[model samples]
Structures are given as C-alpha cells and as structure tokens.
Target: MMSDVFLRIENLRKEFGATPVVNGLDLDIKQGEFVSLLGASGCGKTTTLQMIAGFEKPTSGRIWLNGKDITDVPPSKREIGIVFQNYALFPHMTVEENILFGLVLRKVDKAAQRKRLSELLDLVHLVGLEARYPRELSGGQQQRVAIARALAIKPNVLLLDEPFSNLDARLRADMQNEVKRLQIETGITTILVTHDQAEAMALSDRLAIMHKGVALQVDTPQATYDHPASRYVGNFLGNINILQADLRDVGSHVSFSANGKSLQVLNDQRLSPERCCISIRPERVRIQPQPTDCEVLLGATVTSKNYNGNSWDIGTETELGSVNINIPHHGAPTPDRGQSIVVGWNLNDMRLVHVD
Candidate 1:
C-alpha cells in the first residue's frame, strides 16, 4: 500500500540562467512526515527549500499539496510557514507581539488570537517570558518564539531553513529535540533543510541527499547511511574508506584482489559496474592481534593514534594503501605508534561502489 503523500514535488527544476540549482528533483512527503533536504553547501538544498516556500519560483516543475497544484501560488497565499536562518523576529516586538504577528496580519479575532497565543507560549515553554523582547531572551528562547510565530498561522506545512545554525552546539541539540517534540505534539508536516549530517540523521523520517543539483538518494536515515545508493551519497553522509580493488564477479558474491590478496564482497543487488571501487567504513575495520578463521586479514603498521573520547581513531599503513579504523576505548589495550597489527574485516563489511 502507498502512503498518502501530503506534498509532492515532481520534476522540480530551477536554474539561475544557465546554471542549474535544482535539477529535475522529485520527492514525495507523506502526511505529517518530517523530511529533510540534506547536502553540503551550494548543493541546491537551500534553493529547493526556497522554491517550496514560494520565495523562488522554479523554472519548471509542479508542486502538489494535498492533491492541489501549488506550483504558481504566491508565497503569502501558499499557506506554508517558513522560518529562516535568521529567525527574522521583529526586534522591537515583545515575544507575545512577535508570536501574534501572523494572527494580526490575518485579522484573527482578539479572543481566538489570545487563546492561540497562550497555547503557543505553553507549547514552546515561554509562558512567563512572553513580555520579553528578542534582545532580552536567550538564543533558544528566540528560536522558540520564531517557531511559535510560524505556527501561529496554523499553516499546512512548516519549512525550517537551517533554523539552528546560529546556536552553540549544546543549544543546537536542545533546539533540535525541542522542534522534534513540537512536531510530534502538533502532528504538523515539516521540512527541514540543513547541512548537518547528524541533525538530519537524528530528526528526519527520511532524507533526500542532494548533490550538485540533484538528489542522489532518498530513504530512511539508517538505510541510506548503511546502504548508500552511490559513492557521492556515501561520502557526503560521513566518513568512508575508498580503496582500489581488482574485482571478479562471482555468482552470489564478488571476489576482489586487494594488496595482492583475495577478498570477497556480497553481491546482493547483482551490481555489474564497468568501473568500480571498494568502500569500507572505518568503524567496521577491526584491529586483530591474531587473524581469525572467518576474517580477511591485512598487515598494517599503526602510524598514528588519537583518543577521541569514546573511541581511539587509528591510522595504519597497509600494503594496499592507508586505512583508518576506530577502536572503542572500553578500557581495552590499543596499538601504539610504530606497532604492527593485523586489521581484519568480514565480507559483510565491504561495499562496492561505482568509480566516481
């Protein structure tokens, strides 16, 4: 069965003259789902967000909201709320006034406006501080005010454009959690745009990993991270070890030669690429003092090791090339500098990606 999509973007193409910003983008967002557009800087994620918010018109595309075409709808009449990178709260207005700005613009009655204001103040946990100005509130408080203002209109969709970028790390985490909580309570379909991999992974129901002007993959965070559609998507999400290998396609698995040693990878998808490379996650590589019967072992020398709180980030020099691995520092011994160790990984730990 298919989910009832709330927002549908089909063939969404946007260009600045000859340079394409979003090239033929297609995404279906389910009702009340939190979807995120995640990519690096200049990857067209922000521009896509702007298009959806009606701040920028697509050169060609169709946007459907609840089965109605909204491609040419003006920003104000789109019934979509947008919170910008800068909260854009009126500096002179108090929290109460700021949160009520949308209501006032729409000429909502005073009684209903007061009721909504009180609900929002309680929802964002700014009850007693409603009289305070933006300057007097903390960064977190100001962000809550912005969110409340956007929600004031009770729009059909909420667009968050890097809303937490200006906060400190701790505050950012706090705000992410707060926003997620608010979304759950209100059950409002939301879209977040951010370059932070962890933020997208933690918050989104699904992620659209965009490249230059296209989404390379769109799937659940765990699925996309573990099983990336391409090398670009894999590298964009986090750290990956790309290595050269001589491959031979087997029936159910593919055999490869690395460092003049034979290794095999599972061919679940039956991928037959003309040019391919091996990708292994650093966290999956294990430093074994002795080789196990079921593992493929490589002789490596520990060139550097650094303690990064929870794990020991180790770099090794292997015959194939340099390989990096993470060893959990759970009160266990780790290899020191200039120490020879055997790094091993099972067949399931390897991935085959087309050469980029």
Candidate 2:
C-alpha cells in the first residue's frame, strides 16, 4: 500500500532569466516521512527548497500542501517551518523569547505560550539555557534553539536546508542522530536539502539525487547506493571500481573480458553488449595469499595500503586494472606494498551498467 502524500510538487520549474535551475521536477512527500534533496552545488536542491517554502516563486509549476494550492501563498501564511543553515536565531532575543515570537505574533495567550515553551525546551534538551541569548550559545546549542522554534509553530511540514553544514564533524554526527530522533517523535513531514551524501543517507527515509536541475534518481538510501540509476549516481554515493570490458553472451551468463582476462558474471537482466561498464564496490572484493576457492581470481601486486582504524584501504595493480579494496585489518595479515596476492569476488557483486 502507498503512504498518503501530504505535499506534492507538480512539474515544478524555476528559471532565473534563461538558465533553468529546477526543471520539471515532481515529488510526492508522504505524511510523517523524512525526505532529503541531495546533490552537489548548483544542482537546484536549494532552489526546490525555496520554492516549497514560498521564498522564491516557481517560473512554471504548482505546489500543493495538504490538498491546498500554495504556489503563490506568502511565506508567513504557508504554515511551514524552516531551519536554515546558519540557525538564523535572533541575536538580541533569549532562547525562550525566540521560540515564542511566532506564537506571540498569532496572539497566543501568555499562559499557553509559557506552557508550550517549557515543553519545547524539554524536547530539545535545553531547559536551563532558556534565558541565554543566541550569541551566548554554542553552535550546536543554537541549532537546537532553531529546531525548537520551528517546532513551536506546529507546522504541517518542516524544511531543513543544510542544517548541519556549520558544525564540525563530531557535532554534525550528533545532530544528525538528534534530528532523526526528533522527527520520529514528532512525525512531522520533513524535507531536508544538503550536499553531503552521508548526512542525507543517515537521516532520510527517501533520498532524491539531483543533478543539473533535474532529479536523477529517488529511492531508499541503500537502494540508491547499491543500484544507482546512472554512472553519475554510482560514483557520487561512494567509492566504486569501474571496469571497461567487452561483454559476450554466454549460455546462462555474461562474460566480461578486458586485457586478455575474462570474468564470468550471472546475467540478471538484458544488457547491451556494445557499450557497457562493470561496477563493483571495494568492500566486496576479497584478498588471499594465492588463487584458491574462488569463481574469478586475478593475480595482483599491492600498490598501496592505508589503515583506517578497523579496516585497511588497499590498492592493487591487476591484469584488468588498478582496483581498490577495503578489508578488515585484524583478520588477515595486512598485505604490504610490493607483495603478490590473489583477488576474487562473487559474480553477483559486479553490475553491468551503461557506459557514461
């Protein structure tokens, strides 16, 4: 069964003069779902967010929020909350006062406002620091204040625009977990825009990969990573090994041949033999002392090795090409540079994709 959509963007197109920023983009966000618009800079992720927030009007398209058209609605009347990258908290206002500003503008009573303020403070875990101003708070604390203020309005939809870009690596991880927890607790329909692939994958229920003003692919994070729609998405998500090979249709499988070496791979789908590429993740490749107990094995010499705490990122030169692998540092003896070894992988790990 499909989830009920709370927000829909239909044929959304935004242009500044002649250059199109968002081109015919369509997205349906289910209620209580967390979706992230992910891409590099100038990919139209920010433009899409701004159009949804009513900060920038779309050149041609329609936006529906909870069954009502809001394409031309003013930002103040949209009932949507936004947390900017800068945390955008009022400099002069205290934490509590900043959170209460929206409520006060709507003429909410003082007693009710105080009660909500207490709840928000507890929700964001900033109870004792309510009296402190934004200038006095740390970066993480200021972000929490922004979240509290956004949630205080009880918005129908929440938008986060690179909300963690300002924090350091450690704080960014902490805030990612915090944001995921809060989204589950509140069940607010949230859309986040960010260029960080790991951060988007960590927090989003579904991720839309944008490129050159178009959404290239949209799916679960693992699905997009494992089965990318195009070469660009495959390269963007993580480290992958690409092979230029000539594919031949053998009885029940396909044979990928390159540099006088042939690798037998199972045929999962019909693929064009003329122009195709094989992609495999580094972690899927196994290294052994010699050629033993493997379907496809290649003799290689270790070129480089980098220890990353628990795993070793190894680079090897083989008959096919230079391939990289990530392996457990403790299980096997660490292969040193200038050492000979055999590399093998299961046929299912290799994917036949179009040549980009």
In order, what lDDT does every prediction score?
A: 0.89, 0.88
Q: Which candidate number would show the highest TM-score if scored against the true structure?
A: 1
List the candidate 1 regions with Cα displacement exceeding 4 Å: 1-3, 258-261, 291-294
Which pairs, if any, clash in model 2? none
User: Tens digits of per-residue lDDT for model 2 on 154-248?
Assistant: 99999999999999999999999999999999999999999999999999999999998888889999999988766778888887887655678
Per-residue C-alpha lDDT of model 1 across residues 1-356, encoded as one tens digit per residue:
13498999999999999999899999999989999999999989999999888989999998988888898999889889888899999999999999999899999999999999999999999999999999999999999999999999999999999999999999999999999999999999999999999999999999999888788899999998888777888888887787655668887778877546677887777777456667888898988766575366888999999999999999998866788998788988899999999888877888877555
To one decimal, what is the Cα RMSD in angstroms of model 1 from the true structure?
1.7
Model 2: CA > 4 A from native: 1-3, 249-254, 258-271
TM-score of model 2 vs. true structure: 0.93
Q: Which prediction has the highest lDDT against the true structure?
A: 1
